[model samples]
Target: MGSDYSKDNCVHKPPMDERNLQGLKDYLINYNLPDGHEGYINILLYGMVAAGKTSIINTFFSALDPDGRTVTCVPTGMDPNSLTLELKTYKLAKLKFWDTAGWNAMLKSHVKPKELLRMILEGRIPIGTNLQNFKPTFPEEYPVIPGNAIHGVAFIFDMTTMDNISGNIMLRFQELQTIAAQICGHRVVIGTKFEKLGINEKNHAWIYEYKPLQQKFEQLSASTGLNKQCMFVVSNQWNGEHITMIKRILALYALENMIRNIDRSLKMTA
Candidate 1:
């Protein structure tokens, strides 16, 4: 945790040709990170399968990379005897994203929960038994408590699917909240894949695009006492204007929270 913010004190004044000297003079501009800053934000992304979690990460990375830095999302099947496990990360200015596996039950069976429960009652799971191996063995999935420095978690959900099922919708919400609370209480619910929904509201934002689902989620959140933790709804694949709006919303919700954490760190040190 070191601040990349610093004033350049480069002493080697290169003797450039006339053309290069003019170019250098024009390119000189002041840019720096604030004093006593360790410039990095750790964001943990959680969501269900195909909920556009990876796409949100990709969008943020692409937005930060003016040079079009590429990020990859490698798919893994839910095979029981798979050997290789791959983790993906998308890095940007002062931000590093850890996109964990979405919740799909196919690979989770590898854990043998009944045996683990027996071990817990017998006090064996904690007694010199490897807990990592006992984790819900899903493709691209890791145990929830891997990192302690997770500042915030963007809990992405597909609004369209959530809306399709009228009854038992709150079940997923409860599950999501439980998982988030188990990991850390910093959870923000985001609705992704808004392009599939029609848009006729203000500025074509996904917030307006999925009004029915949004209201359902709000009602569920209120009943569950989790409305306060809810943040923004985003559709990063929207057209130019909508894309800008979504980016701004995500930044305000996700990125700004990280910034506030950094500020808190500075204040505590002071």
Candidate 2:
């Protein structure tokens, strides 16, 4: 199905210009690295299965690619199961986006919250670990040191299915947020599948201006202690039209938030 709104029908926000993109790239290139580490800014994207994390990565690259060709560095599909089994990292200049296996209630046993927290904090996980037959490994067993730790975490959510944020989901979010806070990293929530929300181009602004949607995110932000500005509503489905612009805007917002968080951490420590 196509998006309910088109770029022409919505309020126009300036796209991320080349200058801004280059500036962000340069900033990340010189971003501070932990002692004895040799990695640049690494952002972790985590969310439920089929929440469009991979799609967001692909769309973000597509927006930045000068040739306007969509890049599929990470595999994306509508599979009921998580397509990503191991930790996969996608790099753009000095910024690296680490895509991990989707979090689902059914696979909690295979990939527990604590295990995921350890992987994120240490920034390394056993290669080729799938949901089935996955075993939590001790640090001794996985002696590999990560080049960098996660600087920011983005939680992707499918807005179409967000009618009820169950207690289990909230608990998972809280757990992840606690880990992020302990490491001085930041967390942002990205809501996808916006097209299914019945918002068209004429009222696309409502996505942000509407009180109900804003309140829902605000409640989540309050519960998780994330900055209110960290919440974003995005549509990553490429409908071969103005949806591309929408995706670009969302990607730009997400990147800006990540950069802001990293800068805040640096300032706090400095």
Measured by lDDT, the strongest candidate is 2
The TM-score of predicted model 1 comes to: 0.55
RMSD to the true structure for each prediction, in A, is: 14.1, 5.3
- Taking the candidates one at a time, how many backbone clashes does each contain? 2, 1
Clashes of 1: 2
Q: Model 1 over residues 90-174: C-alpha lDDT tens digits? A: 5555555665445443135345333332222222222233433456444134333322244456767776785553344456446
List residue ranges in candidate 1 displaced over 4 A: 1-39, 65-85, 112-148, 164-176, 182-185, 200-202, 205-210, 220-224, 239-253, 258-270
Error of 2 at 89 (Å): 1.0
Per-residue lDDT tens digits of candidate 2, residues 224-254? 7876667887667665533444455556656
Report RMSD for candidate 1.
14.1
